[model samples]
Target: MRLAPDRRTLLLGLGAAGLAPRVLAQPRFVVPPLAPLRMEVDRITKITVCVRPFRAAGPRLDVERVAGKRVVHNYGHGGSGWSLSWGSAQIAAGKALEGGVKEVAVIGCGAIGLTTALTLLRAGAKVTIYAKDRAPYTRSARATGTWSPDSRVADAAKVDAAFPALYEQMARTSYAAFQTLLGLPGEPVAWTDRYTLFDGPDPGVTFPQRPTTVPDIRFFGVPLRNLAPHWNDLEPSQHPFPVARARHGTSMQFNVAELAHLLTSDFLLEGGRIETRTFNTPADLGRLKERVVVNCTGYGARALWRDETVIPVRGQITWLAPQPEVRYGLYYRHVNVLPRPDGIVVQYGGDSEMWGYGSEDETPDLAEAEASIRTIAPLFEAPKA
Candidate 1:
């Protein structure tokens, strides 16, 4: 999306609030059409951020002994499904590859399943995806496409043994793969700077922290009172709020709808087969061939596989009119103000928690959405009074 001088300048300039004025003269963003979704120009003065908690889905797939056939489990990626899918799928598929299988059944059609299927196809194997829902309907499309890791991947110890190393290797690989997609035909992948404002004493809390094993996770930690040349330090005159401290960093954002459609097109072009089928029970999977089965079902792993550990950290995002001028994103405390092409998605992640995560029988709560917008309205720079 193309940003106006005021929005772009304010964002980049604010990021360097403590720096010299000469630095502000540099052009920050190249004006581009808001395309595809057809967003319009608007001034945003505040934003919100939230913790999109991630949990495992259902019981772990019994790879040890699954009806005497090779099995690889690749589900349970919460909010990080699209972010971590490709890398995780590679590791899971590699495990399945050891059995010399030429055909595989991939369950789930979101980014994870799609990436897994693509990985298998590249590895000289025929792939078929079984799922209850496809792309736009899948949870993957609902994500705010940012390249931050560990947001929804399970905790370190909770993951399987082979998963750790595989997760690391796949994360690096996936990051590199996405780097290739940077500024593609659709500008599918792009970079944005975000500011996290901190006010008051240091209770010491942070977002989407990665488990002990993940690598290359970038974060800027600063004291609540420290003032420096960059975003961490703010002069008394530049302080946006009565804040004791704040932090800032570069973040990667992807257009989920465009990226998903691009991947789906690629999948079909490669002759990949997709079967729309939903499984109510593990036995329901018996209908498929006796070959390797890779489960990519996000929340469905619970009921279908009877996973009691799976929990739903319900998030509600309000789609307000788009603000094409707001190219950069803003995060303060737990609420994030993400500017998407479709609309401005204001999300609240911590207010409510639900159990049956995989259940598609859920509906959006409009009241929750309005309440969240109200809570984070103060963060926008030019919000409507």
Candidate 2:
């Protein structure tokens, strides 16, 4: 559901993120005290790695013919696969059904695949999803479960002229679709507050820039800037955080474990069918009876379609046991701590944006994960009376 915070009490976030934090000119509203978090390495529950399918040119959303079948491609969303699923699916679904085909095949059942299948089913198309495994077993489940629409989405200098508008439409469309899924059985998608604990007063100052030799990470225009409701400074007296400065903000996040189950139930309840199948090459898709196919294979497309453009940007999350009392997230020392229904995610992006660029290795580094937890441990210290 939308986060439970008064809209009027919250300051406009655009100013906090874009411009300098406003100095308080008036009396601030009362902020109820929150429970302290229990954080430590022993609380660790799991550690998983996900290699983002980053393409400097952005996602491939075009149609092509493969073995006499009209294959509509909808993969390569970098780290935004879960964030932009619905909008990207809408675009791919429309292309697959352009000839008014009533039957369709969807390859891969990750976030993008499941969403595309559901979109087609809603459009009066009988759909069958063929995949090696569903969302729970895929990389999407290992996501940090946050709304990062522009996280390595594209390189600003490399994208074509039309990509900016297309990216904007996709980001906004996916954002609107997410709003409809709120207040459902499970908080499959919801909002939460985030704090930036800073040693310095300015939260605008960012991590050191990556060198020119490495690939660039694009920080695109935030399409939902105005819609984000919360951004303000939490006075030191109102809270017990042990930091010199803190900036509070809010944004949408996903609990993919619950979301995967919810989407699967909805797809099956709507009379859609799923098959456990594998494809080695484009020719293998011809065996399927459906003439139209949507390829949502994600990073698997790199080997399956032999696409060299699908660069793998490795990401890993260190999960701490869930603490129901903790409903928010925070950032300190370039390490992120996001609490979700599944678990509390701890991740560290090294000195700059090139933390995981062009890396295909999926092995989780135990040392790196532990280091991230140690980085944010100070924030959870009990406040002295």
- Which prediction has the highest TM-score against the true structure? 2
Q: Model 2, stretches more than 4 Å misplaced? A: 1-27, 200-223, 382-385
lDDT tens string, model 2, 1-385? Answer: 2233343324444346655454433344444566666668899898889889988888999999999999999999988898889989999999999968999999989999999999999999999999998868988878888888888777777888998888877888888988988888769988988888877322232333323336456644445666567678877765567777788888898888988888888999999999999999999999999999999999999999999888888888989999888888888888888888878888887766667778877887877777777677656653422
Candidate 1 structure quality by residue, lDDT tens digits, 187-212: 67777755565653232333332123
- Give model 1's TM-score versus the native structure: 0.70
Any idea what lDDT model 1 has? 0.60
Q: Which 10 residues in a row give candidate 2 its minimum summed lDDT?
A: 201-210
TM-score against truth, every candidate = 0.70, 0.87
Measured over all alpha carbons after superposition, the RMSD of each candidate to the real structure, in angstroms, is 9.7, 7.0
* lDDT agreement with native, every candidate: 0.60, 0.82
